[model samples]
Target: MKIHMTRILTLMLAVFLVIPAFASAAPTTKGSAADLRSALGNLLGEHAILAINTMQKGYDGKADFADAAGALNANTDELSQAIASVYGDEAGKSFNTIWSSHIGYFVDYVKATGAKDNVAKQKAVDNLEIYRLAQAKFFATANPNLNEQELAEGLKMHINELLKAFNSYVAKDYASVYTTEREAYAHMLMTGDALADGIVKQFPTMFTGDIMNNPASDLRQTLGQILGEHASAAVFAMQKGIDGAPDFDQAAAVLTMNTNDLSNAIASIYGADAGKAFNPLWSSHIGYFVDYVKATATKDNTAKQKAVANLEKYRLAQAKFFATANPNLSEQQLADGLKMHINELLKAFDSYVAKDYKTAYTAEREAYAHMFMTGDALSEGIVKQFPAKFETTTPTVPTSPQVSTVTMQLGSKTIHVNNNKMMMDVAPFIKNGSTFIPVRFLAEGIGAKVKYDKTTNTTWIMAGDDKLAFWIGQDTMQLNGMNKKVGATVFVKDGRTEVPLRFITELLGWNVAWGKDKATIIMTKAMAPASAAAHNMATDMTNMSAGHMSH
Candidate 1:
């Protein structure tokens, strides 16, 4: 039995540069996280298919190997372009050098496997191990969040799968070979996902908003998947249609399935009526692409013209649907974008028919990327129209108060008041042997009204039947016309009036307990006489001052 070089090469290439090719095809411009993921996923998935096909042909000594290699090269160029878009041309070139070396090693592995040379096989494996470590180290250094160990493990899994598939093919275990091939393809998708996520997180400004992975933007991701898959499947199906390939039906079915998912997504957001309206409008454009492909394949000039004409009409209808659905989206702009989408797909189909493989792949990438923009535009419109459904919100200031179970420390600036239901802006701090808290926060928390007489430099506190007034810089406070001494006078900090915590809490008939070990002052409603509470508070205050106070 003749050992097929193509079979081994197919699996090897399927697992090697396919992932980098997908990674490189990621949209360089700031897109939604969903868009980035979809781009990488689709590119990786497609490259896997091409890489596997290349190996199969190479093994069989068939002529199609050249086309397969061309497609893989096209994927690499797109990948490098994506990298150049993000990291600069020099970085992209550097990446190409390192990335190409691994592919060469995989080629060497396939060649050695064909010869059944044990020593050569071991050398290839050794080189791959070095490549894996180098690749992991490079990514780990580039992305702080991506651990070197984790990346090394992931790369090892990829290499092992390819090797397993190649070995199975050599042993004539066709089932195992195909099974491993599928696993290798799926693995590249996972790799693309990880790579896209890490890059997006590391450079959030390069993506739409800094929240691509945020659960709130799930709708965006879902839309990107549905629409992006449609673009990829539809384009590939069109190419198959032109070739009259046996898998054309299956490819076409995938396109239809993607359309159904998109319709369901729309129905979930709008009513079934809107989904019904959207389905045909969306499906019509796909039909026109098939028509264009068929016409091109048959050299039917008239049918080609008709398909183009129908697509123009489809564009207007789709644009109108979105404009009517979302007030924020302009119909004219949507039409223009849709037109570009149509042009890209047509160009790709035409190039494929013309056997201009490079242009076909490039156009395919552009068409695929355009769908992300479509998903983004549609999702943005839907989010705007039904903000509550998507659970989208304006970005909040990081320092703004968050509503949660409240907790506070004695010397910390963060105070949890109002029965731990809300956080207050004022932070409590120890000052001059006393813990000073924001008077406004304390008063509001305890249902008291605080009034400051700016001219007189006096602050007044009004509770149900209690009235207390204090003068700034004065040690004496008036409690219903009786003078009482306070440890510290009222002062302003951070635009909030600060008062001694113990004096204010005790005066309002609230009990204060000092936790010396925890450095916490727990306050609750007093159950004893105000005088008893004041005595306990005074003792605790002295202890707190002696043990924990700082000027």
Candidate 2:
């Protein structure tokens, strides 16, 4: 086809640069803030690389464009999820709409380039300009501290740099293309840093220490960089494995180096003993993933299953090691979370084997995003267990609820709670006339104790003398040692344990008021002695320790 390289490069540049702007602004702890930065950097970096690769492939009339495009869409899904982690599902959906539109515009630009249609190319550029303004406005509104004028200026610069890169590529300037690509990748890191800094400053309580000012922030960022890069490299390796690409070995080697970096970081925090234990367990999982890919290529279903079984064992061992290393880390919860990670990677690999590019890319994006959570959990645990090592400072106590009158809607998984202005990973919804909410969000909101028993798939809530226990996937519950039937079944959704709001509130002697017109459920606790409430809140905060806080 020998398509117009310049136009394709321009479209790629425009699409990749705008993506990171939307990828910013998620709720995170000190460790997670670092993790978030790393995740965004890797995601945006990969997008840039993939966009360039796709453009090159299109220029040469290669078949890899579909795979690249699928991977790009996967990146979009992940970016949306990151936003949703801080914002609500509605906001995430809204972001996807705007973000995807720009990608579509770039695709149109590419088509025009291929067809040599100058008019269509100009139209696409016009659309992109409009998109740039809309995106800048969206983020500025979301985070007031982010200067709209500054954001606009920064975006303009991104566009200019991308155009320069594209024009250079068109002129067969390989050196300039490589130089601009590096600049573009590095620029997104700055974008991620700015976005993360703004969000953390806006919600100081949600993150660990001041990301902008703390030394520990550097540690978190380093960890995030290493771990996030590992995920991106691993996914790229897996894709190369399936394609039998010549660069597969190089990509695989890079992935291994990333793992070594992660291990070195662990050793720095926990000493060589812990690192020795961590290296084998961490590296083994990567090996297993590679094995899965190989088996799939050979049509050896039995070998694939064996690889999965090995991963399950790895998850348990890894979870236990972290939990034993840091008391604040829950073994069962870690395992549960780790299981999701393992499955996501396996699914991505399997889908790739099946030649389902869309499904493969979707799984790849999910697997990549899951690593940030893993990084958050591990870093948080390490920071908590060895605070002095991180040069961490104690957080000041707040006198009031981070937010007043937090609201949740029925049949929606959007939770508006916490000081960070981030959405709960799981949303509250109505089931069979009773409202269901994430136990931790509601219980922790009112200074109640919430614990999960992974062995029995049950959750325990203690608010004063009244204790309630519910099993996942069951309608039966225990109220103060007595068996009781609930209107709605307790279940686990989106990695959270959910329970009926009415039953739990009633047991705790709290009022559950419903706003039918608004389809909202408001839980109000009766006024207690000020001293008592403060004590309870302090206790709850203490229970969270440093690592246990939501990332």
Best by TM-score, which number?
1
Stretches of candidate 2 off by over 4 Å are: 1-189, 199-209, 214-225, 272-281, 300-324, 330-337, 391-551
- Model 2 TM-score (2 dp): 0.50
Number of residue pairs clashing in candidate 2, backbone atoms closer than 3 angstroms, sequence gap of 3 or more or interchain: 2
How would you encode candidate 2's per-residue C-alpha lDDT over 498-538 as one tens digit per residue?
A: 87664454333333344646467654432334335534443
lDDT, candidate 1, 288-400, per-residue tens? 88888888878899999999999999999999998987797899999999998889888877877777766776676566556755766766666566543333222234333
Residue 434: error of model 2 in Å? 55
TM-score of each model, in listed order: 0.52, 0.50
Q: Against the unseen true structure, what C-alpha lDDT does each candidate score?
A: 0.60, 0.60
